[model samples]
Target: MIRFEGIHKSYPVHGREVVALHPLDLTIQAGEVFGIVGHSGAGKSTLLRLINGLETPSGGTLTVDGQALGTLDGDGLRRLRRRVGMIFQHFNLLSARTVLDNIAFPLRLAGVSKAQARARAQDLLVRVGLEAHRDKYPAQLSGGQKQRVGVARALATEPKILLCDEATSALDPQTTASVLQLLDGINRELGLTIVLITHEMDVVRRVCDRVAVLDAGHLVESGPVAEVFLHPQHPTTRRFVAESEAIDEGALQEDIAHVAGRLLRLTFTGEDTWQPLLGRVARETGIDYTILAGRIDRIKRLPYGQLTLAVTGAQSDEALRRFAQAGVHVEELSR
Candidate 1:
């Protein structure tokens, strides 16, 4: 488990200290995919660096798997880092090394014999589906293939925690999905704790079990992905969600300005998301409904749908109640 107790960070810039992160408390349970999201310079990279002792906290304490980061010495920090692996946004492969050598570098550094290191590297190479390119150099591979090598190298040490510093931001959308799938599979199969930082909520929705939203060096919001994505509490989080869903709230409101009846945003989850709940409710309540906008998506493994609708007739309230009874979350937007 990882825990932060009033953690904060600052940097010295030409005779003055500049705060990079505000004090915040957060805990990530073991074997879960935790995501930290923010735009550029929101201290996300700083926070992730603190986990592996690459950056020191200016105040407070950070504990990873029971080791206090602030108290660790050079050797102690090295040992702690061995238990935590990291993947960079750019596939930081050694230009001079083959894929297999890149994967074996850490083991070699740890004094493993050349034969043992290469054998372990071979296993990781196959695990990441890069055995065919094990002898190839980074320059010879595509962007996605280079990242696969990075992932394999990070896992070669059998670390308990994996830190991904915007690991997919540099890849195309299709490649991003494939890398995310690989990360998800690794988390489930090896029970490794994965913490990734990204600016995209869609990335979090696809793989993160829980997420924290950072804005201008502050932790603006944090929760389970389903909760944060469906019902954002903070403005920063809501904007992120809107961007992820490609929603223009003002435009949507303008489009519905002249529409009559009650405006409601209905949220459905689990089996309810797949069921024809809206049609059935309209039929049962004898109300007319028009869907203004809607989307069906998944958060991690849970399916969900959100619909904005205008409902009319005397039984509209009854329809709302029926929706609630059917395990749907009903938010009355306007009436």
Candidate 2:
């Protein structure tokens, strides 16, 4: 429901124009959780702002729900923005207002009657599991609680799209997981199309259906999360995956080189049990195999499995061919 075509943004610094986003072309489908990941200067945040009209592009087009952003005037932009909600790294709540009042503030600004706004806020408090904390002030609540208030406030107007700019960056790991789970529930229940921008790859892996990797203000890669994780094409994408898997590249390379037989990295997904394939390879090829480092996890409720194995003797190639026939991806590692 959102599209950017050849978008570019530049700012003048010390009389030199610095490009923040470079000719970005992207599409975010309706009801999908899309993630943008990059380092600090990669312009991920700027890209989000462009969608909400907070930052106008220097060139190219941005459209949401088929309306070109470039054509919107102040009133049009304001009306368009009402349908888009945003939450920031900081909770950005009004400290003086209680949790209930903080959430009602947005609705009230939209000309909703005080009683109606309070009713809506109360409902949201319950939805976000903050019913008991409605009377608490920002200082009286924890970081996660404060963010919940922010989330409730953002949803007060029932926006179709939510832009999360490092929304969980300030919280601890446990709290982050809780907040991410809440977001996931919101997306599933409300069909809210979410755009999450963060440096954390785990966040994308956990909640995002599709992800885009940006570097030096340019789009490096974009695709389904599982596909990207399994077969990363860009160097930056590989680094992100490696970091998430905690792979010791230097040590892995050394080990692969020392192996006396063929080394292969095998990847499997959904319903394709590794045990059967391993059994078949061993029984058919007579190649001794040793399992190295790898992992298995669930992605979108589907089994995702990876294994690194060493196969001895000339039978290694035959075994790998069998694995391929069995629908397993085998990537040969350099010796």
- Expressed as tens digits, the lDDT of each residue in 39-70 for candidate 2 is 89999999999989999999998999779999
- How many residue pairs collide in each prediction? 0, 0
lDDT of each: 0.93, 0.91
Q: Pick the candidate with the highest TM-score.
A: 1
Cα TM-score of candidate 1: 0.98
Model 1 residue 65 lDDT score: 98
Candidate 1 local lDDT, 107-224, one digit each (tens): 9999999999999999998888988998999999999999999999999889999999999999999999999999999999999999999999999999999999999899999989
Tell me the lDDT of model 2 at 152. 91
Give TM per candidate.
Answer: 0.98, 0.96
Model 2 quality (TM-score)? 0.96
Give candidate 1 regions above 4 Å deviation. Answer: none
Model 1 Cα RMSD, 1 decimal: 1.0
Q: Looking at model 1, which ten-residue stretch has the lowest summed lDDT?
A: 326-335
